[model samples]
Target: MAVPPALETPESDGDATSGGPEDLQRQSWTRRTFGAVIENPHFRNLFIGNIFQFGSMQMQLVVRSWLVFHITGSFAALGTVALANAIPGLLLSPVGGLIADRAPKKTIIQSAQIYNMANAAVLAALAAGWLGVELAFWHLFLSSFLQGGVNSIMMPSRQSMISDLVPRDRLMNVIGINSSGQTFMQLVGPGIAGFLIAALSPAAVFGVMAALYFFAVTFTMRLPTKPLYAFAQSDAGRAAKQARSGGRRSNGFKDLKDGMRYVATDPTIRMLIMVNFLIVVVAMPYTMLLAGFVKDILHKGAFEQGILQSVQGLGAVGGSIFIASSASKGRGKMMIGWGALLGVGIVAFSISTSFWITLPIMIFIGAAQAGRMAIGQVLVQSYSEEEYRGRVQSVWFMQFSLVQFGTFLVSILAEFAGPQVAIGGLAALLVLAMGLIALFVPAMRRLD
Candidate 1:
């Protein structure tokens, strides 16, 4: 891609074109872009809201897996729960992306949060002993489905909104900070959930998650209303017209086809999608198998499991902070190189037999993953036009949903080949993927 033109200097009022020392400092904290929209209170609310939202989501994920395993003692059940969460997003996310472009983003995000809150409330009730375990499974599955739908809507809006919050120059930094916050939450939330589950009931964890969702809801509600861009408004009008004419299907293969077409035409985005798919397919399932790794392989229990998970998250937090601090220094290419190194670290993780050995490797893996993700976001957002930003983001989210497929495949492999072998195989696949991307996608390699 061509190097983007330099951003115009911001004005003294911290507006998009004038510049000064105070403006620079404010830009450092809020904008990240030379001429971007960083200082908006609305964006700050959204960013803060995301911390609680993503943190709660992560906590519930760890807690739910543990709870289900504790109750059923079945790896298959754990896989099934993952499937429940993944399928809806995979199926519905494209439509959600279209909606995000056409509808008001803040409203879309708020509605999704409300739906998410409801899901958590139901789960909390089940955890509090107001519902039966059998009923809990059904509720959990339903809630996962709902959450998946919400994510389909929420992910694109949240991602695309960042550019609107900060300028092009600071986009990389903002993404880094956003990712760092996510990693920070991952570092703390799991440990908290694990401790709570160990001391109290699993239901208590759910209750905590519900409270976090409530907080997110409050913050999201406070977001300032921003008008849709002209292209977005046009798309919305077209969609409405099609709906009125009975010519459009909200949920169908056609919507998926449109999304696929958008992704197919953009080479950078296509490569990014493929890489994301590979990562999810190869790396993410380790979380699913972690509890088993702790119990059956490592001969440890819940506390150790939590520590193992927390260590990886700590690594991610460290990585994210590093990226956030230095992204503006123009080392995007180097960061991608480090991401490949992270894959190597994950491979090392698979071969290790002891916690002492695995912990440090996992931390490095986290750092590498975060760095790659931060840089990758910068590349994708920079390359994509505002007209298709939501659609591009949806494609990215779809890769995440499809990661469940990888997880399921790996889970089955674990049953037949064992977790160690399965993980090792995934590591090899990731290395192979890295090599291929390095050879074929020079743009990605150059971090342009």
Candidate 2:
């Protein structure tokens, strides 16, 4: 497929109508990279909605992790709660993907936001003592479980919706842009969350998250609904005909099994997701156990954790922007490169004890995480047919929950070897594994 003209690489020309040579070049760059998506009002609305969601999610992570640690004060407990949250994704992401395939994407997204808003509000209410029940870890666990379920369903719909909103050729560029914005939010959200938690109670922090979720709802309402149901070759028409003829079966398990079978059969998508899974397994436990790292390893507070998280945001922003501005050729090599870079950062992070040293390394870690995961996602979407897009993405996204198991393992290793050595040693092994794959896996290296 030809690349979309809107997202084609800009050629520098000394044009006088728009601006001078330098100014024209900058404008051309912006047009090719961002304008391809932003110029479309629907994309703009989707971007805004996603910004609120991403920011809210980051802030929620900070607040929730802090709360969990405050109450339990155990790395094992924190890891367990994180694992509990992953359970829902393991069980429901494919179902969500199936829904994304068969339903209105925007409706799925907006509905999830509404439920998330309610969930946040309830947590806030419990913290405020309005619920007439004592706040406990179980309460938080319940909230996490519900959020996980909704997220599993909502994410695929939102992801699939992007392909419908823009030309297929522009999908990766737009995903790059969106992931970059998400990384940017990671920079801002946790800093604000730390301050909020310090100044007020969990009630106020969660109330703010509720407000952000509501903003996501309002922002989504502005997006064009046309694309939510947009399907090639009149898919809706075909669906209606099938329904009338009693030819279609609404079987969730069958749909999910078929999606799994499809992914298992495709090498590009299979390796892309598998490598992504391995990387996340090795890299994510640090963030999940970050509170323990801060309190036990660094002897710091929530504020310090926020700073580290924000530093990651900085690295991720740089990494994501690089991909967004690129011509997107040789993406397979790019993914492997980012994976290797990720291991390098994690090893550095594992060995460092000082705040200053870790800050710089955190940026590298964040960049690698964003770049590798975003590229993997782009490949997953690109390799699938429209008819299977939702399910394909769902099956791919299920790897998201695998991090829970990784975190669980990290908790055990941290208990025995401490956070620094456990994470660092694991990361070193991850780097070696990635290098071996790059050297030997001809199919993976040939992804583009």
Candidate 3:
């Protein structure tokens, strides 16, 4: 089968637009790297909105995990909170993607944002004790479950819209730059959240999150309303569209089934998803468990924990920039290399007791995570047909549920084996898994 030109490098927009050497020189370094996508009015709005969206989320992670551990001092409880968040995504993400394919994605995204803002407001009230109800573990758990459901529904449309706004060839740069924005929030959101939690209360953090969520909704509302679906561009995309032409407006379940079949039958997509899933399950749980790890191992509190996350985000920002500027060849190999480095960093982090030493290791882990995340999404979207793109992304998101399950199990292991062994063992497994994939998955290695 002949690969489409979309899979290779396409003509640079710069080549056509640059008037002369003077014009090229006038473009700032930042403009040269990201101006292509950010300059789009629609992309600019979405990008700015995502900064607020991601900021709230990063802050919530720190606040929530710290609250859980502070309340129960049990690793199992932290895992349970993660599980609460994951279960809804496990069940509703596919349906969310189906809706994205059939509805105006902007509407779907804005609705979810509004829902999150309200949810955050309620949590803020509850935490403030204005209701005269003492906060309990179940309150946090229930809040997490509801918030997770909304996120599962929201993420597919948000991710799929990136391709809609940009040219196909710019997908890598756009996704990389988007990830950079996310990492930028990761750098500061948690540190600020930690400070607020220490200085005021958890209620303060929730209030800030609500404000950020409101801004996210405002920016999303500015995006031009698009049609329910775009025209299919790839040969496979056209074939998939035609196959379901008679029932193009069929019920959601049927559309979902068709999407699942498409994914199951495509070898390249299956491999890409498998590699990503395994890496996520084995290597990603450390973040979920880090709160406990910090207190127990590093003898730290909320403030130090947040600082570590900020350092990790610092490395991640750098990694995403490198990807944004990089050549679009051998991305598959590069992703695997990053995953391996992440595993190694996690292993080093697991054994380290000094906070200073762990800071640098966290930076290493963050860089690796940024590369793996940006490259994986780019590959999956690059290879999938347009009609199935949302479904593909939802499936990609299903890994979150699996990783939460992995966190739950590791938490149990930590209960018996200690955090060091529980986390280190999984990191080792990730390193081994990446090596095997590189050696055996020839098609994946040859993706570009």
Candidate 4:
């Protein structure tokens, strides 16, 4: 019920009354752009660490999807790998959120990175034939499954830690900057991974990915072990300490139930979750099916797919920065507009047969996605109470699992009706869905 320590100091106005035009402009620009990184040492570390974290993830996405498609030559198998990754997140992410609320976030983050590094190392060994085993499809699937579980457990802490590190007024700015950092990695990591896969081997790409994860771990190690608000005179703080003292089992389920009830009762959180979930399930499946689509429809190979992803990242970087610099008003409308644009871009992409044409469309899709994510996340973090933030993010993250399930269904459709038809139809559906939501959800449109 009390104000958080992080929110105690409001964002600086930076001499709006006396400063000259250039001074005011510079102050406004810095506040919107890099204020979080410049002001908070912890957040700066997290920002740099995320560069490595996202690099490994972006590369893994390209490599793993390509590996499955390359080995099995089946759209169904690609969807299966996605599904394998989604299942653990769906089942356990709430528990992960609970752990995040109670545990030392730095420890949780470091442990997860170590696990990911090990997973990548094993995959690299198998791919290189150094493990005396051929890299089988099951091995990839198993690694995906395990990694998904770890991510579900780790992501809540990582996301909620942002609020711990900065003031409430700067939440949107920092979140956008974070998105841009990840997008920047996307811009280069995939292309590099693709080139490595082409020049050397998949094993070498995996090896590079493992090293990136290690760097991420080292950076995360510099964050404070305890949260900024850990000693605040609040029930959540006490609960955190008690939970850490090995009392979690007795009240874990109760905490989970309480978190769910909190989300269920809050209309803004509920609407945001619904809209995000719909977009993920209806509009995002194209990504899972992208490799097969490129191969079958665009007549491209792994390098081409990676290039497309990199191009998308370029769009994402521009989009995230734009949102970060924009006024934090009408964010709900911004989210809706971006979501609709994403559908429109996907439709364009699905209809295009030429790789060159799809290149520009991928950029459009990437920007739309970045906008949708940044705005939607800002709204969620802004509206949720500090104590319930981690649990809220965990529930929000369930969309990942649902999107994978959507990918599986879309993959089956692609197998039967061809990638073009399946993808195009889904894009049309997303457009229609967003339009209806905009028409009916007036309250959501009014949210800032």
Candidate 5:
């Protein structure tokens, strides 16, 4: 048996990989499912930090909404709180991405965590009525908006930093692990928040969430400030530096413009972005109608609704683990399959009347959605140039914001056409959109 040339002379760097062209030629993947995440200390920190952060994020959502409802006793006020939480990222994530590209990602991540910690602490105090400060509408609204801004910056930095952690061969596996971890936290955090609020207090839950943010900061602080790959001397690196320094450094909009131009010009990158956006805008919102399905269609209560949601979360974790354990090949086709499956699953669930039937249906729906999320992210990473990775992911984050708008649209349509019909129509549209993407974007379909 002949030893491969790559194995014959492994690169001399300690981590032995880059986020750029050096990794594009990788011919073999790590055999262990979690080899990348397990072996790398930096990534281990990131993984831990992410879990803590996600748990806090979920806790905040529950606590914030609960407290707002208690204070105002109005549904519209609750909607206003959710809007406050969403608006910052919708408007500022591109700017956040630009900051990520120009600054060290670790610094940005840790800084954001610090801000979250402070914000959480203050909000917790207000909830506790500390300093005799009133829990006014503005207080809740301001905290929610600030958290959104912190998230707007933190998300892109964290995601783009993944490219720096492991060998390109292990990228898919790492992403899958991270995605699954997030889904697991989403399942856990809300439950914990509910318990905390019932047993302790909303203020106590916020205080605990603040501690989680601090935990995230502790882990993130240990991450290396510099990328393992020595890109400063590489050709692309030099060009990237030159591109940034030549008057483009003066204006943030120019940097954003360049990122948009790059996405617009690259066929594969553009297609992948569009596909991911479509996935969010269409298939992701099925979860929004879950309450309607459980309450009206299934003739159930909060307990049954919680059961159905938990089933989907479990399925999401299962699906993410499935993707992480597999070797990469036909990733593009798999993405298409997942996207279509999501739509099909939603349509199937819309028609099913039995609790048992809908349970499995939600599982498959969760799996399909999780798979699309993991695959769509990996595709964007693979297609993007290293110079633009942060900015590119920023745009991806921005597109994710529009998903709320899509869900709102779905709610409006559902008012007229019934929930099942509205959901089924969107699912059908998802299938048709994916089919068009596959047909027109041959480069995307052909991606590995």
Candidate 6:
């Protein structure tokens, strides 16, 4: 497939009419306030795909958390399951990124979805008693590992593909819409999953997830076959030449190294990655502890856990809408700064014994989390060069995966310190880290 012409790169002059800082600021305001992604066909398809993908993924997450707790009745198993997912991404992300660069991104993403479908199917079959056997903990671990590997590949391609689908001016808006989709899935998917699990079996939830993947595959197939960026085409050419010459085997590690070098040298990109790392490491683990919060801490049940998760998703949806409609160019940095205040919200969640109070806190946490994530994605996508997009995206995936590792660490800490204390401590640490980040990372501090 032919590659699309690269969109004109955004100039750093900071003018609105002249492609300067002022211009970018004005454009940013428009992007944040409106649903800009609807204007692009490719992005529209991607957005639809994301809705299905995130809905399915989040549903699985909720179900898995419920399942592990139901079986083991321990918080550590949550950490273990999280670890199983993270380890593979950390190990394989570089390769996934490299493959995305050298091969057809659409193809890689499609294949990953297929792999995920297969995993989901296996889990469902096992659950449905069609493949009856002693399903050990190792089964969950293996499935998580494969899913993580697929995510490492899928994320970079998906992130890099956004710029291809829209003009540079619209990247933030597109990202906002993307965030909204994820948040929406979070809101609806988990609630549905919870209801289904309550009404039926864990296997039924897996079957629904498998069906969602089929929808994802169908949506992805509807996307344009062409490579989203010029650099991807160039990378493809280089890979072909290398393959013909037998110079080096084109694999993920080589691609990962190249991506790391790019990020290492670029201060803006480095800052973005670090900000993501800090947030995920410090604040992301709260989701893993939800079951504990509901069951043990709050003295509630599985149904309440699902409600809490849904409330968080509601917050994300609201934040995504606000960011999507707001018109501010350099506001991404501001969003990061302000969004970090979510740590305070999480802290409140930890301490609040009242369900009413905890519900609002979870909502704020979700909103702030969505805002931070949307802004962070826009910053990363805007700063990366088109040719190295896959590698860059892979690095993004690695950061998220590694953050999950950090979350796992937090889970381990919870095992010792207890869930409430661990969650509250992490939230405080995140607030402090955000302050330090704002002070140190100029890109994260300045608003255009």
Off by over 4 Å in 1: 2-12, 15-40, 129-135, 198-200, 227-258, 328-332
Return model 3's CA RMSD, one decimal: 3.8
Ranking the candidates on lDDT from highest down gives: 4, 3, 5, 2, 6, 1
Model 4 ranges off by over 4 Å: 1-31, 66-76, 129-134, 229-250, 299-303, 414-421
**Prediction 6 global C-alpha lDDT:** 0.73
Please, what's the RMSD in Å of model 1? 5.0
* Top candidate, metric TM-score: 5
Residue-level lDDT tens digits of model 2 in 1-448: 3121122112323222212224324565677568645566677788889999998898898789888999899866776677777889989888888898778788999999999899889989998899899789998888888889999988888987777766545556778888988988888887778789889988888899999999999989987665532344365645643664378666777767767776687666667778888888887777778877878877888778878887888889888877776665677788889988988998887777788888888888888888887787777776665666788778667767987788778889989988988888888888898899889987777765
What overall lDDT, based on C-alpha atoms, would model 4 receive against the true structure? 0.83
Candidate 5 lDDT over residue span 1-448, tens digit each: 1110111112534442322333423424443455556566888899999999999988887888888888889877876776777788888887787887778999999999999998889888988889598778788888888888888988888998887766555677789989999999989998999999999998899899999999999999899897764344366666766877683445677778887787788777777787888878877766766777788888888788878888899999988988887766778888988898898999898888888899999899889888988988877876677767788898888765676677788988889998888888889899887788678766666778
Clashing pairs in 5: none
lDDT per model, in order?
A: 0.71, 0.78, 0.82, 0.83, 0.79, 0.73
Backbone collision count in every prediction?
9, 0, 0, 0, 0, 24
Tens-digit lDDT track of model 3 for 151-214: 8988898998887776655567778888999999988888788889989999999999999999
Which parts of model 5 have CA positions greater than 4 angstroms off? 1-31, 230-233, 240-250
Give the Å error, residue 4, model 6: 19
Candidate 5, TM-score vs. the true structure? 0.91
Report residue 301 deviation for candidate 6 (angstroms): 3.4
TM-score, cand. 6 vs. native? 0.83
TM-scores of the candidates are 0.83, 0.86, 0.88, 0.86, 0.91, 0.83
Worst 10 residues of 4 by lDDT: 1-10
Question: Which candidate, 3 or 4, has the higher lDDT?
Answer: 4
